[model samples]
Target: MKKNILNIQGVSEISKAKQSEINGGAGWGFGGIDLSKCGCDCAGRVTGPLYCQNYFGCLQVYTCNDSQES
Candidate 1:
């Protein structure tokens, strides 16, 4: 059996350029999430709010659930 894995470099730069074009030339910025659309049951799960940060025209999703107090 033969395995072929393609490694692409500098792909991030290309994505950044594309994202900038989509944002109308604006730099990366925080794009807030819609909590109403959140499916997590945050009642007793101690789940924190969804945090998003735009880095190089990419939207990164993160959660601070671990920092929440029980």
Candidate 2:
């Protein structure tokens, strides 16, 4: 783990982070996780600003078509 210095309010502190990879198996190499969409509904009510499906289900953050903006 290396050291990171943060200056807040003119105060300096050190923070350490673990090495990127431990054994090179699913390590912090693929930019963490990329869960596009679990197809879970949020605030299930309005299908306007909110996304849902009368046939399928609630199209969530990474599920609904980004171009289909209300």
Candidate 3:
């Protein structure tokens, strides 16, 4: 059987406007993790901070032809 994880292999940023909402709020958006902490460069390129748990490997910045995780 083929399993579809949908979008499990990626990260997402909370909407800025929603960050100001009265909910849990975008902690990461506010200042939880910076681009560098997340291992992304100026253009969101991965700087190899990724720890590959998979026997294969996680996608590189250029592997997907882009900086964004997915």
Candidate 4:
């Protein structure tokens, strides 16, 4: 049997994020979560725009799994 696995990391710099879509309401507006950037080709999930304080304003984490066996 043979198996293959790979790990990769990258930093995506975005000029601006898409504005959150808010539903009309009387008080607070319920809206979708905001992201700097996100997408995955494999079985995976997007984790964060976990806030940061300085020049790097936020982080978006993508964890993916693509494997094959023979």
Candidate 5:
């Protein structure tokens, strides 16, 4: 018997409005962890700050600053 494997990859550009929502927009919306705090130039970097882990569990931020160990 033989098994087959599939490899797939693609890129899609997102508008600023959408990115804002994903990055956690302000107000009563589901948005937190400002990417700016990470001090990373996502546009110039190949891999931007993708995710982070803190005492509150995994979070979506450019960087994780949970210095104090829990």
Candidate 6:
């Protein structure tokens, strides 16, 4: 079970787009998380503000690649 952690905090839009590309290329689509499959329970979204009183929050995505054993 290999884990990939994606941080969408202060990165540029291009970087974020690249992340989406990587996920989509891997067959995860725009939603990214595919919890329907076995061993995909680790896939989820994490979100929180960067600071107090801030409206915008960053996101962190947790995904698993079970194709290869760890």
Clashing pairs counted in every model: 0, 0, 0, 0, 1, 0
lDDT of 3 at 3: 38
Predicted structure with the largest lDDT when compared to the true one: 3
RMSD for each model, in Å, please? Answer: 13.3, 12.8, 15.9, 23.2, 16.2, 20.5
Pick the winner on lDDT between candidates 1 and 4. 1
Tens-place lDDT per residue, model 5, 1-70, is: 1122222245456689988787444434446645444433323222323432221232234444547678
Candidate 3 per-residue lDDT over residues 1-70, each given as its tens digit: 1234434576445678977774552333543323334444444354543331211232354333445675
Candidate 3 — which pairs collide?
none
Which structure is stronger by TM-score: 3 or 6? 3
Q: List the candidates ranked by lDDT, beginning with the highest.
A: 3, 5, 6, 1, 2, 4
Candidate 4 residue lDDT tens string, 24-44: 532224444344433332333
Among all candidates shown, the one with the greatest TM-score? 5
Model 3 residue runs over 4 Å out of place are 1-10, 25-70
After best superposition, candidate 1 residue 48: deviation in angstroms?
Answer: 8.4
Candidate 2: C-alpha lDDT: 0.37
* Residue 6, candidate 4: C-alpha displacement in angstroms: 60
Q: All models: lDDT?
A: 0.37, 0.37, 0.42, 0.35, 0.40, 0.37
**TM agreement with the true structure for every prediction:** 0.17, 0.15, 0.17, 0.15, 0.21, 0.15
User: Model 2 over residues 8-67: C-alpha lDDT tens digits?
Assistant: 355444334444333343224644332342235354332421112322354234334447
Q: List the residue pairs that clash in candidate 1.
A: none
Q: Residue-wise lDDT of candidate 1 within 1-56, one digit each (tens)?
A: 11222244433335676777763332335554534433423332323334412221
Off-target runs (Cα >4 Å) in candidate 5 are 1-8, 24-70
Query: Which is superior by lDDT, 2 or 5?
Result: 5
